[model samples]
Target: MRRAAFGLFGLLGIVGLLPQAHAAGPSDYSILIISRERLEVATSCEIGVYINDQLAGRLFQEQSTSFNLPPGELDVRLRYLPGQVPGCQPGIENQRSTRLQLAAGQINKYRIAVDQNGLTLIRAGLGY
Candidate 1:
């Protein structure tokens, strides 16, 4: 019947669109990975990750977290958060933010590091 034939054609058309729908999914966002897997930051306090002035993630020693965000420039700041641990009190360190340029479908990796200035982010290899 013509109706059956038309239904089969409609199903084929829908199937043809599946690959395009999936292809657009990953290209819409970028991956941002922040890690504390190094010994550069010798502290017991949880470090707060601020994105656009909002607390987005917390990292401890030997730990890492990631986010899939839309491609663009992001304002990222790292600072020590006040916790039950002694000497981990807030407002005693710098609160400067770092600017990151992320492109669509790209992956960025950074590890926490410390310098004479204070806590900072250092770019690292993405092999891990």
Candidate 2:
């Protein structure tokens, strides 16, 4: 009877440890944070964030968004999206996609700003 009790306790202990063992697996994704809090972009239009050439999220002035993506090369594009405000129509401005290398368990930050050429994504510090 003592041997059976010991085996039962060992099985229970193993069951309790199962979840912890699974949680130790390597991380599979990275974090992407895009903010439009910069005043450099004076336009009030909503900006569309495209990931891998597909529209993923939209950002308005003073707004931000985040995504959990698999670690690898990502093609990010920003375009003006039409919104409630007038003059926020799409396809009027010329823009290009930016390629970013992301790693697992990493946090990448970017902010929308306007350069002499036009609207662009600027790499930003984690504090922002």
Candidate 3:
């Protein structure tokens, strides 16, 4: 009878721990994109945001976009959409790409801009 009682208690204890054992921490990774370059506005073009070589967003000047991404190495690129505006061409000078190793529940922000030299992606903040 004592062995049976002890086994019951042990089984209950294990059952109580099942939730904790299976529970996972937050695994969401996010990226915030900001298009604040005067160049895009001046040229009246929408910027194409790419993730892993896929077009993710077409951001306008001063606009922002947020994405929930998988935690891993991501290739981020920004380019001008060719037909979005007049005088806006698909020039290599107006694009940028970067690889980021993101962790679970982490958020990163970036800004796209165009300078005299070329396009650039600048890290803007850590969250939101």
Candidate 4:
């Protein structure tokens, strides 16, 4: 019957649209930024955190911030900006960026350290 054929076509159209929608949008994920542990570094100064050269968060000593991001590649950096707040400001030292690939349903964590020169970022382990 024509009604049965039209219903099947409509179901096929809906099923086809699901894949296209899923492919176009990536799943949401999270990235956690932790301050690296060091006794010699100044704890009072809030270090600047950047993603893709943009100021994304501030890190205090032994503190952390988590950001929800889409699945993709991101440029992460840490800086020791002396007089900047929620802005990208950095000197020659301690200003570096590296690319990170993120997948869905994963929680990526990184650490930042500040010393005499400036800031240092490193991939961290989740201690059990």
Backbone clash count for every predicted candidate, in the order shown = 0, 0, 0, 0
lDDT of each: 0.90, 0.88, 0.71, 0.68
Q: Candidate 3, residue 49: CA error in Å?
A: 0.6
How big is the positional error of residue 58 in model 4, measured in Å on the Cα after superposition? 0.6
| Cα lDDT tens digits for candidate 2, 21-106 | 44566768999999998777888888899999899999887999999999999999888888899977775576678899999989
Stretches off by above 4 angstroms in model 2 are 1-26
Highest-TM-score candidate: 1
Q: Give model 4 RMSD, 1 decimal.
A: 6.4
Q: What TM-score do all the candidates reach, one by one? A: 0.77, 0.75, 0.64, 0.59
What pairs collide in candidate 1? none
What lDDT score goes with residue 101 in model 1?
A: 94
Of candidates 4 and 3, the better by lDDT: 3
Clashing pairs in 2: none
Please give me the total number of clashing residue pairs in predicted model 1: 0
- Counting only residues 3 or more apart in sequence or on different chains, how many pairs clash (N, Cα, C under 3 Å) in candidate 2? 0
lDDT of 3: 0.71
